[model samples]
Target: MKIEACAILAALLFHSLSVSAQQGETAAAAGFSKDIAPILTKKCVACHGPEKSKGRFRLDTFEFLMKGGESKSASVVPGQPAQSELFRRLTARDEDDRMPQKDDPLPAAQISLIEQWINAGAKFDGPDPKAPLVTLIPRAPHPEPPSSYHHPVPILALAFNPDGTELAAGGYHEITIWNPNEGTLLRRIKNVAQRTHSLDYSPDGALLAAAGGSPGQWGEVAVFNPTNGARVRVLGSMPDTALTVSFSPDGSRLAVGGADNSLRVYDVPAGKEQLVIQQHADWVMSIAWSGDGTRLASASRDRTARVYDAKTGDLETSYTGHQGPVFAVAFSGDGQRVYSAGRDKKIHVWDAKEGKEAGQIGGFDDDIFKLLVSGNWILSCSADKKIRQHSADKRELLRTLAGHNDWVYSLAVDGKSKRLASGSYDGEVRVWNLEDGQSLAAFIAAPGYPAAGETVRASTRE
Candidate 1:
């Protein structure tokens, strides 16, 4: 009886091992060009590519793969999938030392594909001109990210739909679309190649205008079809770095501001420069055209915010109240009131038509980098890392959102839903459900950010 039992056990073990090997065969049948190339493109190429050969490794070709890097050994041994150094790095947890060194770890399915490919002896017919490594084209370069919090991309600008159903976040190299309620990233707009600075959606939500590029180097102000991120119009280019952009309320015109200290207007579809409102004495850091598009308000390091006539290219008002450089400007819904903030550590509201001080709200201890006014409240974020919500009518401090450990530089408002979005200098963007004064979501730009002394230490309700 004992002999019979041993024979049965040995047969069962042999069958199981055969099944495992066959599973690997199925994956190998999918092949290197089809199954493995994608993993290399998304996860391996960044560190081991032509532009940056970190560790002296290049995974672009099978020859490069077999030659390995400075470690002086093949990263993958044919038929020994379990002993591959490439696989080890892929599974490593130390972000600074890990392969790819950008976002989250590769998916299990992707890692499995490599294991099966190696177990099949890592055989390849090499690159084929006719085949060209066809892959399932992802909808966009970044596609739908699994999580914004852990992504390597840092958010530079964000805007919301009028109905407040969607939030659009522009990143260093991509844009993250999210569900405001769930704070989940839905899609990424990846058409622009460089780190983006400022962006705004059209009134109807059909178009998006984005600006800012290589620091000190101005980039293209592109009008994109937000649904698919197809460039509808290369509206214009800034000869000098532009910091902010705004779409006219009617969507017929675009206003861009930057270091050239000019606010240039371009006719949207025609992509022609309509008029250059180059009157500011310092970098025009902010631009906002009133509801009728007749007046353009600009804030700058010139220690003042000016309102210009869109048609005549004339400065209509030099509204100055703050003692320091003004950094942000916004017009109220009706265009009757303007809010400007700056290093003065106070927000100055002005009568748009009269160009006189309407009210002054002060309390922030640092430069006020950005501001957004919604309903009856003015939400301001400053270098001190405090988000202050003030009574728009009374200009009184209602609440200070204190939690971030760094300076806040950008603000987005969902008018209908009362949601406030803030992007910070420390490389993080967060959404607040203003109804209850609670944070809805925060997307950290890059990992290892907020190094000592540079982070915002504001405290707010979660």
Candidate 2:
């Protein structure tokens, strides 16, 4: 009887071992590229992929996955699926502890495949063996200004010097400085960027900062001498396109917003990054520094605006009332209030000190692209091809300056001169007298480049 029992026990043990072996083989057959990469691209890449990295975690490549993130440990534990943070987060019961926050949890089958891959030693089979493991560097040369015969190029960004003597309009690889009073081009600051998205003058009017990049490739922020257009300092480059740049009240630092969904502050004199604030879930569209320069406000395509401590990079508050992508943000003269506008066709005002909604202005027929706060007025330009002026303290529509035949892309206000500059997609730049709501000067910025259609007559209303 004892011999028979021993044989049965041995047989049972052999059967168990065979099943375990089969399971291991199945796990080993799960390919990293074929099975695992797709799941990550679809489910994880939105937050951890290129353009943005939440929690400092990036899972776009096998190397990045192994390097881990802020936790500073391998997210995947080879041969130990149960112990892996990657698998654990996917299966976490608590929503807060889950891998993809605010998104639907991965289906069970997808989770199983990831677990199997990790259990099988997490080997990688890259798409190309010779491909570089890092993100591709931008190789495209900076664009040059179009020849005189070429069509008028759209102006996307505009700014005024503190003294209101000059206006800076962003062009392809150049910043065109104009005499706002004479309605003539002064000089072209050349070879700055391939596409300029934002421009700002230092508070003291000594420097002009240009922000832009080769979309989907790289981004740059360059400071230049406004007097001679000499390149002063190239702050640095980013992995994605930068859309907005603003100088601090004292001009000692700069705040930059970019497609990477981050707000970075750089020290001007030291030429080094001082702080990186990552909170927005989508592209950061605009950034504004307070009058005191202690607080910074940023708007994002994530449908929210946020205020951050400029010095510490800490998030002070977030304004979430905008229903669409927030594209423009500005702080009032005293830095006590914040204003933001976006695709939702509404302007939201917030108390900077309390982080509470103060007021809202809505009536635009299209997306508002840029905003300027001049004294008690809030001026905005829109895709509707018009520039609208509003009372800052009240929800009153002051006037609408309509002249652009295409989308209005940028706006700049010179309070000292009482002039408002508006740039449009058709390459027209119109300067308006705020006091009388009259078109003071009008000209085609890039003369021959009329964007999508033939050049229209400039509005020269007195």
Candidate 3:
């Protein structure tokens, strides 16, 4: 009976030691809610969270965590830390392979904690797996009606067709095509972008690319058949509003600048992102592709302009003399020079190859919003209520077209017709005789209030 008791005691002792050893091995086991979640929120969420899923991998919930990303493989392997991609990324020594590509790698202690959790079976006590995925996009509010009929809706962008037969003016949620010679509205392209900020006709005049978005909500680039206004493709649903879009000279690619402080180039045929350039520090307000389609110039609210390789997404040159946000940018016809203007009240010309400031036109009374290169002329419109033309080669002011009562937001030139179009904050659209700087016609783009006290339902379209 004593011998039997000793055998049982030995068995019990062995069991206790086994449990103790297991506890020692996982002494730093991480809890999903306590340790691992916070680390992910702080270190991983920006690119992998609701606003963006870089590789389609989201760390916000357990289901997405388990579903993994484009690879369709598991990110975390329960009970096998060595085999886990998450563990491998956290502990990766190579910068290019490391998680959080833009930031420093996770600390060793934090990595160890994650590894311990994976080895401990990677349990999650957060939201139920069966719960619906959290909505990443917020509900957009109903847009307010236009204030008055007498005052037109503000036009933010303008483009003249390559054939010089039609002009496109960007209005609230629509683009209006007008006969330039007759000053009559042609067709309205409706139900497109919320507020169109930029428009470009493809080189062959076959397509029109419009760029803009609801501020703080979403950004999109919509390509349309110019003849029928049929959408050819919608390229993006970016995190923030896109301010400008330009088609490459070859018409094979499009470059977009956005509030997200990045420049994205999209393949025209594939409708997929070809490259993402992340050198800008703030909102990228404008972008222009080189005449040869080899380089791209971008202006930003970060008070700088950058020129980079269009295909490689490599920074070629940075123009940083502006004291305020750079709102406009354009490449010269020859692609040898770049032009930019902004709140600094200056228009700067840069040497495309050397990246040096070639010339500048200064002394504007207010912010300059748009710049256009027509022939040898550099036409710019300003918040000071004036559209000024300057000689691109000589750096001399050629003419000042003064008719806008409010800030002029956009400018387009028709070299064939010798006509220039300007859009303004007061919802006024004015066409000018470029030769004499005379206003050929003036009309309101947006409908205004009927009279002082009479209630008039705003005409959503003309």
Top-scoring candidate (TM-score): 2
For residues 238-349, what per-residue lDDT tens digits would candidate 2 score against the true structure? 6567899999989999999998788999999898889988899899999998888899999999999999999999889889888999999999888888999999998899
Q: Which regions in candidate 2 have their CA more than 4 angstroms from the true location?
A: 1-48, 51-143, 447-454, 457-462
**1 or 2: which has the higher lDDT?**
2
Name the lDDT value of residue 251 in candidate 2: 93
Best by lDDT: 2
lDDT of 2 at 227: 86
- Could you tell me which 10 consecutive residues in candidate 3 have the lowest summed lDDT? 130-139
Q: Model 3: runs farther than 4 Å from truth?
A: 1-151, 447-462
Which sections of candidate 1 miss by over 4 Å?
Answer: 1-154, 445-462
Judging by TM-score, tell me the better candidate of 1 and 3: 3
> Which TM-score value belongs to model 1?
0.63
lDDT of 3 by residue, 1-462 (tens): 999999999999999999998766764456776677657755776677555888888865667777778865579889998888788777888998889787988888888788778878888755455321221222243254333334456788889899888989887777778876666677777557778888989888998989988776557788888778677878775656788988887888999898768899989889888898889878998898877788999999999999998879999999888889999998898999899999989998888877799888996999999988888888999988899988888879989998667788988888888889998876667889988888877766654323212322333332
Predictions in order: lDDT: 0.73, 0.83, 0.79
- Give the per-residue lDDT digits (tens) of candidate 1, residues 64-101: 67678898556998888667778778878899766667
